[model samples]
Each structure stands twice: as structure tokens, then as C-alpha cells.
Target: MSFTQRLRRRLFPPRDAIEGYENEELVDTICRKTAAYQGQANWPLVADLTTVLDFGGGAGVHYKTARQQSPDIRWAVVETPAMVRRAMELATDRLRFFERIEEAADWLGNVDLIHSNGAIQYVPNPVRTIRSLCAVAPAKLIWHRVPISEGEGRREVQTSYLSDNGPGQAPSLAEKLVRYERTWIPEQAFIRAHEGYRMAERSPDPREHGTYQFRFVPD
Candidate 1:
């Protein structure tokens, strides 16, 4: 919170590159959310499954509700190495974290569901990641808040305030700004990337502009 740093942030904003997403405040918030998560509309989907591969599932917060409903559910989260280190604090017998998709799949034995929320865009290569996820051959793949394009895919920078991730925090000028590069995958290209999977559901995400949710199943 130095004067120079504050001034630089005002001028440059959140466009600064993020490395491993290691923000301490954000980590605290994720841990708190993981501890207190009640549920979401997708709770039933999670509750019905016994094993899941969560891509970009920060600290595996979504497991809270699923664990409540299906006590034996094994949830494996695939995240960055830095995040894996921080998220290990919340790991338990049924919950685990890995830095690679293959490792997660190996640990889970059989993945009933693959889930990702607002995460694909942040990856360096969405197509490569999608291919990796497909290699797991999960029964179902769900993506929420995926940025889609009607034409050729492209990269863009997303800037947001830390409070955006908070349920109770108020916005402030001093709130830390975050910027990350995202790829807007072409609609058709994205759909075709899953070699043997068919797009079971595709719909616009009500909360995010130009983004959609998708569900894929074996063809």
C-alpha cells in the first residue's frame, strides 16, 4: 500500500501478469468459502457422484456441499503448483489436490464427473487442457462460465477487483486488482475438441457476458 505502488496500480490497473495466482488474500477467502459452503444449483449433480475431477477448482471449495450429501465422495482438484501448496491445508481423506490432470485421474481410479467453473479461459492453452481432460474418459464433463466466440478464437485480458470473488465484501479503490489472460474459445471449435464426447447441454451463462455453460457426455 505504498504511494508509488498505489499510483502505479491506478494507472496500469489489474493488467499486470499473474503468476501461480498466489494472492494471500484470495487464498484466505477461498479457504473460508470452502469451510462454509452451503450449496449451489449443481449440488444435486455433485451429490449423486462418488468421484469427481475438478479442473481449476480453487482449494476444492465445491466439495463442501457434495461431501455433505455423499459422505463417501472422492473429490480430486487439479490446480497450479502454488495453489496446490496453499490448498493442501483443506485436504482430507476424501479430498485431494494435484498439479496435473493425469495425477488426479490416477488417484480417483474412475471419475464419474469432470467439472470446471470459470477456469478454462485462464489456462495457457485451453485446447490442450481440454484434450487432457478428455483423455480421462469421465462419464460427464461440465463447464460453467466458459467464454465462447462465434468466430476465430483469441486471447484477452480480464481485469477484476478482489471483491468480485467475495460474497460479502464491498468494493473499494484500495481493493487489490487482478488481471489474467484468457482465451475465448470458438464455439464450434470448443464443441469439436472433445473427440468422442457430444455436447449434451449448451446455454448462455446468465451471470457472465459472452460466456456459456456446457455439459458433455460420451457420444
Candidate 2:
């Protein structure tokens, strides 16, 4: 770990967002997510099973521990290279890992559910990234523990998140962690890019520190 990572580990020990979720709260979250997905119209109507793509799912720990209701259900996790390495070590027969959302090119159109939680704030180009996911036209997209404060204000506004996405050493954590990431919030362009997906739910995070949690899906 670098100095910044060392300092972060001291202040906030190595942790995943889902790892911070309590068992009961996590259960409730899963229930809501399932309800939302199943309640959708014509969801996986022709498919015999559901496939999931989780953005920023760490090490596949949550999926590994959680019992799947159906043996037919499958999931793939996309994360940073570091997390991808960790996730690969824990990947199961149904679990896969990708360094980027686009890296899972083969999964396009095959995925039925797209999931993200507390991960939008860390994307350097959320607009473009979301557009990529939207292109796949998944049946449902679920978001949780996402920040919503947009627009410039008294405080300095941060646009890009720092990461090792480029060909260089990783950037400091604060450079990326310190921002609101309002672009994730629905707008005309985002809505158009996301295949007419609209905001279905916006509420305070039941299990984490976020201004709001959002759920978007096409009607």
C-alpha cells in the first residue's frame, strides 16, 4: 500500500461497502431489490434464468456468502484491477470478474439484471460509463447508497475521480472519494442514454451514509 492507502487503512480499515451492511439490513435490501426487479414488466420473459452484472462488487464476497434462491441464477462482478484480482481468487462457478464494465463484452444482451451500490461516486466518467451499461438494455437497473448532490456550490466541485484506469500509478483515495457525483442523478441526456429509464425510487440509504439511494428502470 502507498502512503495514502496506508493512511486510509489507519483511519478506515480495509472494508467493502457491502461488508459494512448489517445482516438484517442487507436482507431487507435484497428483498426490495428482488421486488423491484420481479415487479417489472416482461422481465426475463423468455429467459429461463436471470443473469446479474454487479458494478463494483468487491471480491464477490457478498454473492459467495448469500444463498441463491435458484441454481439457474448467475452473477458477474466488475471492479478495478486490484478488486478484480481479489474477486478472481474468490470467483465461483457462477461468478466472474471483469476489470471494466466493457470488459464483459460477451455478457452484453445476456444480462437481465444490473446492480450497483455505493459505487457511482468512484467513477471518473459516470455519464459515459452509464451510457455503456444502458446500451445493453438490461431489464432492471438497481442503485443503492448513491450520492445526489449536483451543481456547483459554496464548496469546491469535483468532476473526475482519481484511479489507476490509465497507464500510471494509482492516484490517492481522497482525490476520488471527495465528491458528490451528481451526474448519476437522472437528467435528459442520461435518461435518453439509459434507454428511457426513469427514476423509480429515491430515498435515504437504509444501510449507509448517502444523501440518497436511487433505483432506475425502463417502464
Question: Per-model C-alpha lDDT, please?
Answer: 0.82, 0.54
Question: TM-score: which candidate is best?
Answer: 1
Model 1, position 6: C-alpha lDDT score: 65
Clashes of each: 0, 0
TM-score per prediction, in order, is: 0.84, 0.58
User: Which candidate's lDDT is highest?
Assistant: 1
On residues 1-219, what C-alpha lDDT tens digit does candidate 1 reach at each position?
Answer: 469966966796664333236666665666565555555544678767899999988877678767777889999999878778878988999999999999999999999999999998888889888988999999999999999988999997777766455333333434566666889999888888898999999999998988999999999
* Local accuracy of candidate 2 as per-residue lDDT tens digits, 1-219: 489966875686433322221233332333233223322223332245457788866555334333244445577788766555543555666777887676563654477767777666556666677778876677778777765545421222443223312222342332322223333444344344566687787678877553466667776
- Evaluated at residue 135, the lDDT of candidate 2 is 69
| Model 1 bad stretches (over 4 Å) | 1-20, 23-25, 36-42, 166-174
Where's the lowest-lDDT run of ten residues in candidate 2? 159-168
